[model samples]
Target: MKIRIMIVDDQALMRDGLSSILQLKEELEVVATASNGQDAFEKAREFTPDIILMDIRMPGSSGVEGTRLIHRANLPVKVLMLTTFKDTELILEALEEGASGYLLKDMATDTIVQAIKTVYSGGVVLPEDLTAQLFLDKRKTPHSDLEPVGQPVDRSLLTDREWGVLSELGKGLNNREIAEALYITEGTVKNHVSNIISKLEVRDRTQAAIYAVRHGISTTYDF
Candidate 1:
């Protein structure tokens, strides 16, 4: 099945341009286009596309808020942020709000199209050149009491199940993917993720994922 897609951007030219370019791919279909984030959400609820290409900044209801809306509403669509700006804080905020990926507007057209397919297949995407910057700027060091990296983390602090979830989260799989990987209920995965965050004392799942990477705790499960 072709991946259903929605293009959301403040600029009409950008939205239309992306829609035109993406429609050429036999594997993709541009189902809808919205001028801003709020409009995107409304259309998302109505059209329910498999993926959304969201722009970070907009006049009313930015992409971050739009992502949060879709996430909190439990929509089935994955959001991939597209923007010209390279702000690390916005990247973290978008991911924290449940964005599946972030892409620069300057990237090759094929790269953006592949990113949509990647997110549609339950994978996560982030700009490579900026990930290091994100880690250095937005990724916080774990709390003082948290176990130091390379040390064996106490199982008591985080159970084996929670560890599994953490590892999957580190790989940037959403809850559904993690549940499928671990053979657990999504509800159970959510519970484990909550516990992972509380036990790790990180600000959010984004930070928790970063911690998982920094600690070399990651899943070997094939994507």
Candidate 2:
């Protein structure tokens, strides 16, 4: 089945151009297009596409605000932000608002398409450069005391093995690499990953990794 997609951008050229390119893919179908965030949400509600390709900067409304609105509405669509800006604050806001991935507009068209596919298949995509920027100066960004809306998380909620796996995630290790590093089977790693996500109240591995990084927890803190 072709993945339904909605392209949202302030510029008509960007929206039409990207839609033209994306619709060429056999795996994708351009179901809708909108000029601004507000229109994007309206189109989303009307069309219910599987994914929305959002741009950060727009004249009437911003992509971050759109992401917040979409998440609050609990639409069954993933958001893949495509923008030229590398503003860390905007990137963080989008992530917090449940964006499946963030990509710079200058990326190769092939890469953007692949990111859309990845996000469609329940995977998180983060540009390595942007990821490093998120991790590099963590000390400088004022820490958010806000936790995911739930009962407070504690170290006791996880087993030592789960903590070890989460710390490896903080280092950006994939399942295979984490398994090899910890001398555990990949299936075991997958199981641990599932448990960690549930225990941490995170949507996915990306959020779990962010939680570990923010808490400064590591394998050394585990068994």
Candidate 3:
């Protein structure tokens, strides 16, 4: 099946360029285009695209806020943030708000398309450098206060295997990659991820990762 896509950017030229590039692929379709976050939100509900290419900075509501709104709606529309700024805060905020992927505006068209597909396939895509930076920053923060003293984690809701899966997830590996590293099936990895999310009381993987880091459940180099 063709993957439905929506482009949301203030620049008409950027939107047109992206739309044209995506339209070239046989399995991708551009369902709608929006000028800003608000318009994106409206079109999202109307078109119900499988993926949304969002620009971080917009005239009205920023893409971060828009991502948060769309995520809260639970619309199955994965968000891929495309922007010029590589501001760590913005990137982390978008991820925390439930962005499935992130790419620089200057990325090659092919990479953008691949990112969309990856996210649609229930995976995450982060720029290599950005991923490295995240790990380095996470490592620098001391976890002395966050470590659980008595027990590793409650296994009532999570089995030992599930906690192991969550620990890997805390290291920023997506489902497929996590499965590969753990020598398990993707379906099993996903189930464990879901259980971990519910047990941790987190909204998304990003938040769960943060929780794991803060609680010392996972180490930076574990992944």
Best by TM-score: 3
On residues 91-111, what C-alpha lDDT tens digit does candidate 2 reach at each position? 777888888768899888899
For each candidate in turn, give its C-alpha RMSD to the true structure in angstroms. 5.6, 5.3, 5.0
- Summarize candidate 3's per-residue lDDT along 1-223 as a digit string, tens digits: 9999999999999999889989999999999999988788888999999999999988888899889889888877889998764455676678888987688889888888888877787666665445555545544557623233122454476677776776666565778888998899999988888887888788877666655544455553322
lDDT at 183, model 2: 100
Model 3 lDDT on a 0 to 1 scale: 0.76
Structural similarity to truth (TM-score) of each candidate: 0.70, 0.75, 0.76
Show model 1 residue runs off by greater than 4 Å: 139-210, 213-223
Q: Count the backbone clashes (under 3 Å) in each candidate.
A: 0, 0, 0
Candidate order (TM-score): 3, 2, 1
CA lDDT of each candidate?
0.78, 0.78, 0.76
